[model samples]
Target: MTSVLDAKTLRKEAAEARQMADAISNQQDKDFWLGIAEGWLELAQAWRSGGAPRSTKLKEDSAIGSLCLGT
Candidate 1:
């Protein structure tokens, strides 16, 4: 049977998966990281639609991070 994930668990899993991606050195690793990021974004969106409050600071910080990455 498939398991269900609560928001907090999903968040933790997503972060851990991302860390794994970072510790690798190959195209496959980068793709894995992208997948983790997508999963987190999906979960975060669902949480928002489910009436959870958004973290404005998170968005602001991430935007700055993206700028630094130049991606």
Candidate 2:
């Protein structure tokens, strides 16, 4: 299991994640979001499942697959 980050480390992670998210051009900008999906996947997984996903290898390894199977 992943170790929980301390408040400072978690804050740093959150800031970086927010920076990446703020760089998104639009809601439909796949490449931008996908670029940082690792962070998103981790945070979301924790919120829902109480832990990080094993990885953010992009379950579908293609843009087309992603478009057809977005969350």
Candidate 3:
């Protein structure tokens, strides 16, 4: 239950970071927010999987990755 709550909180934070990225006019600033969002999402996934977060490598096909890569 606590883990579920933690994952939810992390997901919420990820959403907020994405929103911040959306509001940024500078590409670098937007990328920074997107990176933060990616980290939060990775943390949420790790919490759900009962493990520590790993791998900062961005998924080439992910939405965040697409944005970060400008694809």
Candidate 4:
């Protein structure tokens, strides 16, 4: 399925990822979540600035797909 996310939604997801990272005890897991949050925030900023490319079908193995799918 194709999903088009707005900047607001992306920022919300970023915040949620950051909160999850804060609750993690493992350094590796925390870092992973923080990275995801950063990616989401960047994407949101790009969207707000109209620099983000149009949404396309994401491969299941892609990093962005994993982030968006919460896999």
Q: What is the TM-score of each candidate against the true structure?
A: 0.50, 0.34, 0.70, 0.70
- lDDT for 38 in candidate 1 is 53
Per-residue lDDT over 26-65 for candidate 4, one digit per residue giving the tens place of the 0 to 100 score? 9998987887777777778788988953444233564566
lDDT of each: 0.58, 0.51, 0.79, 0.75
Model 2 bad stretches (over 4 Å): 1-4, 28-71
Looking at candidate 1, the ten consecutive residues that score lowest on lDDT are 56-65
Question: For candidate 2, what is the lDDT?
Answer: 0.51
Report each candidate's C-alpha RMSD, comma-separated, in the order given: 9.0, 8.4, 8.5, 5.1
Residue-level lDDT tens digits of model 1 in 1-71: 12765677667666776787788789776775756555565556667579533433234245322432464
Return the top candidate by TM-score.
3
Model 2 lDDT tens row, 1-71: 23764444544554565576677767666455454544444545555666644555545764323642583
Between candidates 1 and 2, name the one with more favorable lDDT.
1
